[model samples]
Target chain A: MKKIVIITGVLTLTILVGYFFQHKNQRKLTLVEKSDFLQAFATEIGQLWRNADLEGDQLCKKALNVDDSYYQCHPDYFKCLIDKNLIDFRMKKKKVSLKISSSYKSIQRPTHIEYLFPLKVNGLYDLKLRLKDSCREVFLPQRYYPFLANQRDVTIEWDNFNKKVFVDRNLSRVWEVRQWATKVKNNIVLKKLKELPASDIAINLEIVEMQKYCSYQGKHILSAKVYDAMSLHPEDISSPEVKLFRAPYFPWSRKNTKTNIFKIQKKQDITLTEKQSENLCKRVYAKNCTSVPFQSYSSLSSTWMGARETLGGVMEYVTNTVHPKENIILSSKYYPWSSHVHRVGIRGYWDGEGRSMNNFDFGKYPIQVFPNSLDIGFRCMRFK
Target chain B: MIQVLLILFTFISCNQESWETSLQYDLSSINKVNFAKNYLNKGDLKNPPNTWLKLATFERVNKKKCLFYKTPYREKKGVLKIVESLAGKCSAFSKGRVYNDNFSAFRINYVSSTHAEKSNILEAIYSTGKEQLALDIPLINITSPKKYERYDNQLDFSLVPDVSFGEESNQLLLENGKVCHGVNSECQEVVGYKCDKCQNGVVEVVDYNCPQGGSKYCGPNKCGKKNQIACPRGYKILNTKLNSLCFEGSPAGFCEPGLRTYCNEKNILICL
Candidate 1:
């Protein structure tokens, strides 16, 4: 019995010792294998970067040397340049910057940076990003990187988080991306836009110089949103393309020349038979009116032909032709028609849709209609 | 003769009891061997002698509490018996002895502090590492002490996925690919892509396409073809080897200056 007990104890101790030794050795081997793989990985990539630049079979030779596996793994490295973004390419020395303002009285200063190529200017880039605020106030999209991307009209998004450093992720969902695609690269246009009041969002490209009121042809035309113009068409213009129009007048003859506004005859009110009001949903008319049919008064017209034309012809024509016994208002819409360097100029005609014909005389002013000019348009403003 | 036979039977029984106790528990980490003896005397833990091996498992009860146990050894059906609680104890390793049992395995059960009643049991029979074993212990059993469970746990460099080294390695290299911001050594042609009729001296640089109508344009090999250049987007040509005797008898289009189109190959040019 003693002999049997001693044998069992000896066997158990020997088995446990063998198991411990085996487990320790396995762990050591695994560590060694992992170390070898890591060292190889580092060495291969290091060698890949050593060759200044190689293409085709030459480049493949180096890649193959790194590891036939690496070349097999990434085939895109040696493909065509167009479809590929050339993410691993050289960059230019130039860079673009951005500036923005918020209605909350807080102004974000513009940031400047050096530029790189390929990514610097390709398709209109987007700086899609998100920033959390303690308060839940909704700020305008103007305060984001998308706006800056569109402002620069470049493929490079020089996006910075918390206003620190720029990072370019290939994010295209940002608002500025669409605008960047649509934007025309005009440094002068971008410069003029930055100088205007922050609320003026829409920028018009018809007018070359933006100020109080841009004069075209022999008449003066006020600034307006792109939608307000008669012949201004943003859809027709290709990306990175800007067309300039010049008026045929004085020093102001080419004021909005670079712009694409067209002249159209203003609409006059019809002496409607009450039947036309209740029966016809939309009246087809030959003339264009400043106000809609059911409105009590004609809305403000963005068309201006110098101070003389506004006080003399446009004001008088609206009073006599549409409303003759109401007050009038003129104001500019916020932002330019396009995202270019331009001013906001909209004129409002308030409650002036009735009779005041005999009070104001027309013989005291010189009147003229701009026919060949294609840079004139009008918008309506309402009265409280 | 009857008295001698009785003494031999008593000695044999005592030897069996001693062997069973030794196989059942090591009791090394447990300070009081007398306490283990008392537990055995109390019939809480028992061991039968002449067994090949007995499986012992450890269970950690709560953050500071754990238990070690001994069990009958069956190939896959060994049950553990609690030997001692390891909570509030030192981090000394517990070693198990393989008794006469042919198949024996170690298992660990840990009860988190947040969950006193629930305990997580992890078996070490088929697992290779402790991490895998911990994972096998279901998340439902790993009662997190605090309400917040942060995932800020960095990737374990040791257990990095094999796929990461293969696919992500190239991605990392590309992302970290440094640009030679110098001039002359770095020259990039503008508007050099897909210009069928090269305008403004912007020649229709061949974009690494197949010269043969049927063959597709493979990577970076645009050699010995008229107007053939490195694919615009695929590669940027830099540091030209203008006139070298390295390729004396090569075709006019083959290995020419600014046209050694070998895709992604590395070399220290010996401009002989």
Candidate 2:
């Protein structure tokens, strides 16, 4: 009787072990893993709810698609059932029963609102009502309206600037393109325009002035835009459209810019104090500079010259800085956007410590970066 | 196990992306830029006319802006103090071009700032006494110049004078004579210097700038030197004669009166 019982136990154990291995090989996500994903997604949605960017949709789609293939049949993650380049979404008020922890630790609520996404998990599709209303404002203060200057009816005043082109970047020479739009005979016309064939490509930038004894005027901002010419409306800017439109973009300075809104004339080495570099951001956005972090290397593309370094990760490049000098890199800590930092054995701080933990693989999705955080610095290049 | 998980979390959760590494360049399919017929074709993605770029290594201070660029010797140097008005369109344009790789040729045009705001039209600012057109270059070359020899960015256009001008009018009398008719007597005609090096060079003759009475320049190369030698008192200087006639005075030795003589056809003295 004992021998017969042992044989039966062995057969049952083998069957259970084989079943677990088959499920694991198929890359199925457990119920707990799915719950963790929803929790993290609720956090990103919190940020998306506040920031009013012209291209805010890109962020929403990026957060959902990042590290998870919504296509090609992956069993471990939820798949965005839709197959389109752009992900169009809007928040809904409908409620459904879900087991989700509150996103906001401050406010307690009975039911959370439904969040719609173009994703499918198992037999589920269309919408996910499993979110906590845990949204809170980060450093960015919500400006009601930012006044934008898109109207060309105002007279263009005098400004002196030479339209000259040189590739902008460190250790690389890249071409610049600017498409100037003008209203002629009540029709849109582009002049001296050269645009690349790509999807919504632009570099966020800001321009500030440093005079010997003067407070300069004029708009100091440009954001990524589409189908419209850049306009200048000076001061009194407080419209949501203006805030989105007036965000500074760096590539615009290098391209075919018509209006000379600001000019930086220096007869010597320009050194801005830490307070001044902070002010540079204030002048452009008209907001507290702390809202925007330094910069992100993930925004690059395959077009750049040093394709290897740009893709491999600039954090690695920053660690190996013999070119830009540590002080120039720390100019943001000072104002006038100048002032050099003497490297006396201080390499500064890292975002999340661990020198060897960076990933060199930049697949289809770009690495996410928050502009308002640390790793704040600028890059200077020698032209080819 | 807990310590291992903590280390992994720190390593994977890297944040703070940077713009210092974001590439700022345009990309085109790997094909040589088309410069057919030595002109920037409209569709050519590589090089186009009026492509302007400004690159500067910079630093800033209290109400002070400084810019640095490569010096003439190719060393980086700072030489600009940027003072600016509130941000707006940079309408004040100043277009200039170097003649060639030698950097020998230049045509600069400065748009009138005040007028640009009102006229909505950009016109070159030219004053009467200032240089409007350069001479020593051909009219055709200046009016419709050739592109730079080696570089394509060098634009080809004449320097627009600060003001616009109408076509040449025939109403003005030429030195050949306004009308050499019998009725027109002593018709004063204005003779203009036909500049051999025209267009890229200029020449203007103000009657006020000309010498009056007694001394006169006769050849293309005038005013050989300052003329200090003058006829003595009571003597008149006459230049129409083959040699200068210093009348009312003795000719150093002997000569006839009225049909005065000092030297003949071969520079030999003869009495008439």
TM-score for each model: 0.16, 0.16
- Give the Cα error of residue A328 in candidate 1, in Å: 37
C-alpha displacement of B246 in model 1, angstroms?
70
| DockQ of all models, two decimals each | 0.01, 0.01
Residue A383's C-alpha lDDT in candidate 1?
A: 7
Clashes of each: 81, 87
Tens digits of per-residue lDDT, candidate 1, B120-238, equal 22222323223332212221211121221111111111111111111000111111112211112123322222211111111112222121101111121222333343212111111
Candidate 1, residues A1-384, lDDT tens digits: the string is 888867766675566456446433222222112322223322332233222133433433332112222222122332222133222322233222211111111111011110111111223332111111111010111001110111112211111111111111100111111122224354554553454332222233222222111111001112111111211222222321222221121111234343221111112233444544321212111112223331111111112211111211122111111111211211111111121112111223333222233322222121133223111122211000
**Alpha carbon lDDT of each predicted model:** 0.22, 0.21
Q: Which candidate number would show the highest lDDT if scored against the true structure? A: 1
* Candidate fnat values, all: 0.00, 0.00
Q: Model 2, stretches more than 4 Å misplaced? A: A1-94, A99-252, A256-317, A321-333, A337-384, B1-272
